[model samples]
Every structure is written in C-alpha cells, then in structure tokens.
Target: MSGVFQRISSIWREFCKRRAYGALIHPDGIAAQAEELARLADLALRSTAALSALECRHLAQLAQSMRQLRETAHSPEFCRLSADRRLALHRQLLTAREKLLASLQKTQISTEKLQ
Candidate 1:
C-alpha cells in the first residue's frame, strides 16, 4: 500500500474514533483523503517521482496550491466547510509534498529567512 493510503487509513481511523466520541464527521473528510490517495496512485502509476526537475516543479506547484487553499481558511467559503474537512484537506496536500520532498535532499533545498 502507498504511504498516502496508509495516512488516509490513519486519518479515517481517527475520524471514526472521533465520531464514536460524539464528534461529527465532516462530509468531505473522505473526499479529501481519497483525493490524496488518488494523487499518490497517479504518481506511482506514472513512475515519475521526485527524481527529476519536473517533479520538483510539480511539488512546488502543489505547495503553492496548498498555500492558496490555506489562505482561504478565513474566507466565508472556508467557514462553510466543516472543520474536519478543512483540516483533512490541508493535511493531505501538505503531507503529500512533505513525503515526496523527503526523498530528494538535493532538490529539497531550503531558502534562508530574509529580513
């Protein structure tokens, strides 16, 4: 099983447990995790990993999308979404980039903080 799937499973388990604790399950929780798992499956199927500069660009794009989505967190649209959904979606996208980037230290260059 892919790491994404494993993470999704972990998230689902936590979600279920939350519900058992009387917590409401966000309708979009599964969708977000499913999207993440699908993304990983797509990557594995294509066999294109962080091995190339293209993958680096792809990861960067994913990071930018995540940032934009997060910026929307304070928007009314974000408020409309369930809290679980927002957290799950953020976790999926961020974890995807983190896992992929962990594999390529050369490409995993970090920028210095500027004043």
Candidate 2:
C-alpha cells in the first residue's frame, strides 16, 4: 500500500477501537443530569400531595432545575425521543411549575387581602 493508504487504514482502526470502548467510559454528566431530573420528579410529586413550607422549597428548587434541564435538552448532545414522550415530559414539568407559581400568587393575594 502507498503511504496515504497506510495512514488511512491506521486511522480507521483507531476509530473502531474507540467506538468499541466508548460505552465503558464514564458518562458522569449524563448520570448527574438523570439524578437531578429524578430529584425534580420526586419534588414535583411531593408538591402535589403536600402544601407545607418544605414542599414549597422543593418546588422552587425543582423549578430552577427544570429551567436548567430545559437548557440541557437543547444541547447538541441531547437526543430527542419520540414526540409523545417528549411532549408528556414537557407538559408535566410545565404544569408543575405553573401550579407552584399560581399557588404562591394566590397565597400572596390572600395575605394582601387580609392586611
């Protein structure tokens, strides 16, 4: 083989090797994001069932993480799932965020009315 052909073959072999081992590499960022999303999901659930101050704190944190999650979803590395699942998750997060905000607003209005 000529010099260019030799270099091309060597590069192709290296790429294949990396692909074979890529899954074994730690995907810490993906894991971290999944953990965060799981936390937010739990908080969203808690908020729906309880109206205590702690639930409010969790909801606030979830809202902030959700904004970050939305940003992460837009990244090039993120893959879009089926349309149905994507829309479902989006609706869940948005509904939770809005619900929390509306409840807070109502509480504020009631407090103002009493004062």
Cα RMSD (Å) per model? 13.5, 12.5
User: Which residue runs of candidate 1 sit more than 4 Å off their true CA positions?
Assistant: 1-51, 105-115
Model 1, span 27-110: residue lDDT tens: 344334444544553444344433466655665565455445545545677556544565566566557656764554434333
Candidate 2 has a TM-score of 0.39
RMSD of 1: 13.5
The pairs that clash in candidate 2 are none
Per-residue lDDT of candidate 2, residues 54-102 (tens digit): 7667766675675576566646554433333344555565566466556
TM-score per candidate, chains pooled: 0.39, 0.39
Error of 1 at 20 (Å): 12
Model 2, residue 90: what's the lDDT?
50
TM-score attained by model 1 = 0.39
